[model samples]
Target: MADKSNKFDEKLPFEAAIDKAGYGLYSYIMTALAGVAIISFVCIVFASTIIVPTSACELGTTGSQQGLLAAGPVVGSLLGGILWGYQADNRGRRKMLLVSLCGGTIFNLVASISVNWIMLMIFQFIAALFASGLYSMSMSLLSESVPMAKRNLVVLLVSSIFLLSQGIMAALAIPIIPLPFSFHLPALGIYWNSWRTLLVVYSSPSIITIIWLYFMQESPKFMLVKGHEEEALKILRVIHRINHFRSKEEFEVLGLQQEAGQEAALTSSVKEQVAPLFKMPLLKYTIIMTALFVINQVGAFLVWLPTIADQFVRIMQTGENSDLNMCQIINTESPVDDSVTPCSLNETSLLIVLGVGAMQSIFNFIISIVVNQVGRRNIVMMVTALCGVSGILVNLIPSALGSAVVFGVLTLGVVVVGLYTAITVSLFPTQLRALAIALAMTGGRIGSFASIQILNLMLVNSCDAGFYLFSSLFAASAIVASFLPDDRRGKVAALAKEETHKNELAIKTGND
Candidate 1:
């Protein structure tokens, strides 16, 4: 029944097969799904910034306790990122994503009913443990689903969605958090207020994401690498049929070319799978990505953007100290007396947060357009260097509006995160991609935690010194970005060549 005279008799590489499948409705839908997954994670992590100040009175939380509550998700992610990555590599991307999303959503729902700050923190922490690896898993699956040419653009589009998530959160929180409704449950000794309602709203995205993922197929490239040739082919055929509006049989890729030793990775232990990244050529990439992550994660300052914006707005409204810098304005803030003060959300601050997210989202979209022409390495260097200069200018300007604009530029570090992630996907093999990304992000989270702590100390002790320190980190990141591969294609080709050599050596030894 086979067409013996068909011109495409030879097997093709997976990337080539993806090209033949073409990009159409399917790629767009998948990229959107990936963006939703990102939103599910982003909303949960950032919801804390809003929840902390709003819930402080009802939860009876002290300053230190509120700090712990704010940090709960970060700590949880720190513990769980590598574990989920390991499972994703050994099992499958789709499975781990489903498992994590479901678990995270369930815990998030439970957290909404929490009566105490400790209860809320613990539940959210557990939720974050489940959600920590969603970003990397989503990126890896998206990377494998599309053709090589569309990979960077689609990945950055999803990153744009990530930036947009902040605005979405602020928009949702604005109306929901200010509602003058409360249901008191005397039996449970708790009040179901706006903050609790906001938590429920935040969990909605994850619930929808889980359902969307259920209809999605496992990565065909993942199956091909694991030696499921028939399964992979079936998925590819469906893709071709949907994208090309042609018969599945017409897809010319008869078989997929698997990377050498990829199937062997199926049986390898986690330690065995991870060891190679530290040994030879991968060592340089691993080290460089870690350094980039450390510096990039300094964007964690955005976590306090709402708080700073609140103080800035208050100062401007009072027409007090009009010529003071950001540090001076922040120092003038009065501490909230949780025991006596009414919990109120600031509208101007929420609007500022929304503006920041919208601006960054636009910037990310612009970056996606230029990335192909400008190159990933170049963009990373250019953006970081520019943001570093902005970081210094943030403290130098005496006007609040000027400083705010510079602060926005400083947050462009978020754009670098997306670029670095796209690079990680191409830099590593399919078998190890998830784990490698997880490791790099874990480093980033560690950096984020340290920077937040150090920034808090510096902001209180020496505000100018704090800004200078982060500016230096951004500068250091730009220097390291210069070392990235001139072209990701060359790097991937070299990795493929190495894998082919290993495969040949294995075959020769078997024959001997």
Candidate 2:
């Protein structure tokens, strides 16, 4: 018996590498880096909904223009998700993440100084094109780097960046955008306003990303999948050194298993690669995850709370808010009056909304903490069900605070979306992992875009009907969550191997 464990090692080299490296300091470094990238991306994401339209008002654009501007990043993300996703699958995860973040920051800065609506949209579109890939790629990179035991919680840790980013943007915007600052240049055909300065401030995360790449390393598992066994081993040992606080420990595992005939071609066309995800077991998983993305629009509605809560205020308390809704208020066809800017908020209201966002962040963190104990599927279904019921409670209840409380509960549904991302990423192997996440998020990006356009139309008439519609969607998501396969227990790699073996057999039989 030369080596008995060699056969077991051959079958699951990736798992073996993970076993050797384990989870400690290396995992913490990767998790923190991924969280920062997510925070940077999310900083732009939150800005698009809140700050972009406010910028539109600052520039005196129309409702149609506002809708188009808002959709710019979502569309960029739609394309970037797929394009960068396929690239990450082939080129390497870490490289694509660095490229996307760097490029996104550059264009974000350019968009801040755009002369007109067209320039703003174009620059922002290009920014989105480069930046959106970080979303799915960072998730895969983080997942592959961490141990199986801590995967779900790690994903949540990265996702909590959204809440942190939102608060940071809000805190910055409250002070920056409200300034009586103005710089007009007729020669440049640009009238720079406080909103522009504030956007540049929000885009500061670009610098953060550049610094992150300095300390990070490429994922060893990705190297293994790409047929670099020696390089893979080298990286794993380095991770082991950092994690175990030692320099000279041998990793017993040789390498991750490579598919038969995989050396014949390093990569395939995007379609051939992505097709497997749409077939059999993987197909069902993709659909269920996409449904989660579609139903998570409750977070978007909550963004309108300031406008909604403003309706309950008496004229004596806060001047004429105009009987107009959020869409009408922000999307004025004429020049935005100097007297009332979007950021013209009383200190009381500003503090209250920030408090609400902080509260939602706390609940999301709680979900992450309990995810390991409660199970991923159980957590999503339970939270989304309550989110659905909260829709009804919002209507039955009275007072601005009552509706506000219900909407805050509904925001918890967004956290469930993060758990869904963690669950979805766990299902695919490295070859299809990033692409699967991108595909599922494509549905989400589409939903976000369509919802904004639809809400701009719906929020005008029956705001009550809007809440009911969102409620029904969340309820439907809970039903879909019921059908998703729970793969937390050593199933993803095994399933991928089985699927591959079945394909090879089918090919052999056809040739025979």
Candidate 3:
């Protein structure tokens, strides 16, 4: 058998040729796909802040009922992720993406006009089912398309851009859609309720993204594996044309001829592809990664702003010892009312959260540059440890200094989030990539659900215990990080191939 590390062993000639066209076109396409994925994050992160509160007010929902409404999308995402992963791996990433985006746009548009909580929940779930596909497919497609040397950086960049989109949505949710059209839409029969209007605006990106994706080609590697040599060649030709500004006719002729020869020489059995993923070596690595991801999700859920806001408020009050009240903070008024008294944080907390989000985006961008150089394991370890430290400080700080401490802790949390995003994208093989991401993200969703429940039960009663619980989860994540293999800078395909060979040998010896 050929050494799996050799690029020739894994990629067909035509597949390699696509990468030769230049990184610019490839990077652009990845960024576009990544942007689509960000819509899901934006919706999920801002739901409690911008969507749920508005929904609760407009629908006259009880607090417990509001919690269920908030959980609708995540519940939908958990199921959608698993379904989309199977579809993405078996069908094609491009097809999955088109279907997901188009469906999401329609669902979100409908959600904007929902008459009651039931209708709203149903539409939100439908939207999530489509939106969930964006992240898993994007990671799988980008990981398979790029060169091994540049793969980590590309993945990091994609994740960073996705995070940045969340910040953009946060900024826009308050000032643009909710504020400007809040009253104007009532005359137009639109009833520009905060959450409804936000959904309407959020769906706008999906419309443009779906249209753009329609013109994009499928992954060349996916085409080759599925025996669509001509289709793969046409895609390669287009890429070459885009990168070099060559005549499409000339590139098509060259590409088809090259792909035809390569296809004849390369043959991979289905068993070879499927067997290694479930056997030893690969199985071991999968278990370790899955466990690390599950632990990471726990911390991720705990650190989310909405999940801990009530607890942080209590800490702020204790520190300030002022008559800062939540009752006066109405939807029409600013978050902070200076006329009453100075509290721990009012409108400044919003700014602090935005600043933290911006800092997260910047850190993620830097991680994109340094990920391939420093390697994945070291970065994960360092970031996980820092997150643990921050989580502890968020709870330990005195009430008077709580706001400052919370801001600093949030900054560190953002940095950790960037690192986790980079590492998750780099940890799986192309064939199993979507499944791996879905599984990890599903873990996060589960954590988010549990954290929400904890908040409803515990934080509503004793807020301090909630912070301690969150901090403990962060510490556990650091412990899990220490168990992961140091394969950050390595090629996932090469690693998968090597593990396959070892598992094959072990099976043969056992039979003998």
**Each model's Cα RMSD:** 3.3, 4.6, 6.8
Model 2: clashing residue pairs? none
Model 3: residue 78 alpha-carbon error in angstroms: 0.3
Give lDDT: candidate 1, residue 409: 86
Best by TM-score: 1
Model 1 clash pairs are none
- Candidate 1's displacement at residue 384, Å, is 0.7
Worst 10-residue lDDT window for candidate 2 reads 307-316
Judged by lDDT relative to the true structure, which candidate is superior, 1 or 3?
Answer: 1
Model 2 residue runs over 4 Å out of place are: 1-12, 246-250, 259-265, 302-353, 487-512
| Tens digits of per-residue lDDT for model 2, 410-496 | 666777767878877666656777887888888888888887677656766665677788778887787888886544335545644
lDDT of 2: 0.70
| Candidate 3 weakest lDDT stretch, 10 residues | 324-333
Give the top-scoring candidate (lDDT): 1
- Candidate 1 C-alpha lDDT tens digits along 53-79: 888879889866767787788878878
Which structure is stronger by lDDT: 1 or 2? Answer: 1
For model 1, the superposed segments whose C-alpha errors exceed 4 Å read 1-10, 246-249, 334-341, 488-512
lDDT of 2 at 353: 54
Location of the lowest summed lDDT over 10 successive residues in candidate 1 = 503-512
